[model samples]
Target: MTLQLEDEQAQKLPFDYEELAKQVIDQVLGMEECPYESEVSLTLTDNTKIRQLNREFRKIDKPTDVLSFPLVDFQKPADYDLLESDGWEVYFNPESGELMLGDIVISIERASEQAREYGHSLKREYAFLIAHSMLHLLGYDHMISEEAAVMEQKQAAVLKKLNITREGE
Candidate 1:
């Protein structure tokens, strides 16, 4: 998997963010008949940049922890079909020769805040966010009650599998 990270604000994380992100992405991709070769872009920024993005894209006018921009529509089965099919519309990035999944934007500042607020290490919080955003890129959402349950379960399962506990174990 190709994870292009654009880290805007460099802060000392508990572990290497790139390696952790790749692991989370691998876990997500391994859950299904996924592509062995794919790409996803991640941007780590401050609250100010994320807030501007939130205001511009979501019109929220406030910074959120993370944002996901999926390349395909989740509701359609064709989205998955294209992954196996080698057609022109396979979401390929010719420049990198990898299937483009989507983009994830995360705010380090917000993640740190959330970690403290939730009584966890920043590493666990960042891993959770990366896992959560990876799922979102793979067509998971918590917009509704049922969907929220599924997503929450998936997130928890991933975290548990990775041993990224809430207590920072």
Candidate 2:
């Protein structure tokens, strides 16, 4: 898996945010058993920029912690066979040949605030957001109760596996 990460925040976080993103993304892909090599883009921005993105993409005029834009539409979550059957050549990068999974935009400012409000480390909050967005990229949604429960379980599992618990530093 290849993660193309960019930080656009004015004040960068003290921790190694890139490494944490990569770890969470890799763990999500592994857990989902994605067959093909994948590529994902992540941008770390501030509340103002993220709010603009949210307004443009989702028509919501508020800042959100993270936004996911999935490139491939999966019939079933994490089902690679469907991609092969459907012949989704449009979802692959010609040069890299990696499946272009999706793009993720995160608000560093919101994440920090949420971490403090939730009584967790900033690292843990970032991991949770990334994991949550990864699940969305892989065709998962939390619109309904059952789906939300599944997504919550997966996010918790990913953070736990990485030792990025709420109480951990």
Candidate 3:
């Protein structure tokens, strides 16, 4: 997997880019059994930019910590079928022979605030958010109770592997 990271904010994050990206990639690939290569774009922005994105894409005028835009439409199997029938045109990345996973936008300001609120290091908070967003990229949704429980469990397991603990845990 290849992760292209970009930071638009001037804030000094606790984790380095390579370490954070590796953790996210490990979480995403470990949860899924796929032979195909994958790629994702991670952009760290400020509150204002994220707010604009939230309002424009999600129709919510507030800034959120992270937002994921999946490239592969996993909502319907028919969409996958359509792409498959077209000789897998949509899944392949020309340069790396990887599937374009999608983009993840994170608000550095929000993450910092959340770290303080959660009583955790900024690195742990960033890793958690990145893991959550990576799951979303891989078609994991928390819209339903059961689905959310399962997703949360998977996320916790990944975090635990990286020696990150949740509050009071």
lDDT of 3 by residue, 49-93 (tens): 999999999999999999999887666411334445655666779
> Hey, what RMSD does candidate 2 come out at?
1.0
Candidate 1 backbone collisions, by pair = none
Best by TM-score: 2
For model 1 the local lDDT of residue 96 reads 73
- Which has the better lDDT: candidate 1, or candidate 2? 2
Runs of candidate 2 with Cα error greater than 4 angstroms are: none
Query: Candidate 3: where are CA atoms >4 Å away?
Result: 75-87, 167-169
Better of 1 and 3 by lDDT: 1
Quickly count the clashes in candidate 3: 0
The estimated TM-scores of all candidates read 0.91, 0.97, 0.89
lDDT of every predicted structure (CA atoms): 0.83, 0.92, 0.79
Highest-scoring model, lDDT:
2
Rank the models by TM-score, top first.
2, 1, 3
Question: How does candidate 3 fare on TM-score?
Answer: 0.89
